[model samples]
Target: MKIRVHVSLKPGVLDPQGRAVHHALEGLGFEGVEDVRVGRSIELDVADNTSDAALTDMCEKLLANTVIENYRIEKVG
Candidate 1:
């Protein structure tokens, strides 16, 4: 089985990295760029029998920082 995780900063959080990218984009003449936010995606291959509880633990411990971000997990064969 394969597990994919997406982690993103909350809507109200300040994203300095994203802001820098946005500024660079504007400087390059890319018009209509409204806002930007940075996030990360992690892919993991685990046994098919891995439990949901264990996956959640992995996200909590290593995949995401819950203090300022939210994460979603998807399982694929």
Candidate 2:
């Protein structure tokens, strides 16, 4: 089975990379842009029998920083 982990900074956390990208977009004369938030997508291949709890555990332990970030697990195929 394939899994996709989407990780991103939580609201209220400052994202320097996102800010930089937003600034660059503005510099390029892009208008009507409100805000930008950067996130990461991680793809993993595991056994079909992998449990949801295990996946959640992986995110909590290593995939995402629970303090300042949020993560969503997606099962793909």
Point out the worst 10-residue segment of candidate 2 by lDDT. Answer: 32-41
Clashes per model (N, Cα, C within 3 A): 0, 0
Q: lDDT per model, in order?
A: 0.94, 0.97
lDDT string for model 1 (1-77, tens) is 99999999988999999999999999999999999999999999999899999999999998899999999999866
Provide the global lDDT of candidate 2 against the true structure: 0.97
Off by over 4 Å in 2: none
Where does candidate 1 clash, by residue pair?
A: none
Q: Which number leads on lDDT? A: 2
* Local lDDT at 72 for model 2: 100
TM-score for all models, in order of appearance: 0.94, 0.96
Query: What TM-score does candidate 2 reach?
Result: 0.96
